[model samples]
Target: MEMIVHNPTEGIYAATDDFVHAIEVRSPSRFLFIAGTMGLDSDGVPGTTLEEQLELIWANLRVILAEAGMSVDNIVRLTSYLRDPSYAEANAKARVAALGGRRVPTTAIVAQTLASGWLVEIEVVAAG
Candidate 1:
């Protein structure tokens, strides 16, 4: 499979011949796309800190991957949104601790909450 990232103003998939400008992901197995996830827990409340929120997101990711008989190692890509882009370094450290490496999905860092007072939203794609 392949992954394509396009500029919003380029009329959808109007990729230029500059292949190097697009990020492509390919694997020999299945492709998985996860729904956007928020900081709220299974109990429906925000996690305590940025680290705590990342932990919950990681847990949720595990459950989702397990339900499909896979794990984070099979993940090919991930996309995350943060309420504050300035927190990226901290979030990255937390994510590294969770994934045991610094492998990040083709990601974007934005500063806006999906819901008021929320700090992060994460979605992922995996293949192996």
Candidate 2:
């Protein structure tokens, strides 16, 4: 599939360098709409810290993507639900590391998590 990054220089506010305004995928054979995944351990326990949660989230995402015959490179969009707005920088860093510095369209919002310990939740859309 051909992924097109759309970051218009005019007619809209400029998006941060870490993410683009939108992504347009062309000729994708399949699409995977992953649910909001949290940084839970093997025993399904949420992480106590944002860093730990981010780590687990990316690891879990790798496994989930692999199971669907895809990888982080196939991710066209992502949204992060952060328990605290302060976690945004860490979340962005982790996402960049997970995708090997290849930025796709992304959004991060400060919100409360259902689970007390889950500092962050991430949902992604992948195409292949």
Tell how far residue 114 is off in model 1, in angstroms. Answer: 2.7
Query: lDDT: which candidate is best?
Result: 2
Tens-place lDDT per residue, model 2, 38-116, is: 9999899877788999999999999999999999999999999998988989999999888999989998999988977
Per-residue CA lDDT of model 1 for 52-99, tens digit only, reads: 788888888889899998887766667778888776777667666766
Misplaced by over 4 Å in model 2 are: none
Candidate 2: deviation at residue 49, Å?
1.4
User: TM-score per candidate, in order?
Assistant: 0.73, 0.96
Each model's lDDT comes to: 0.70, 0.92
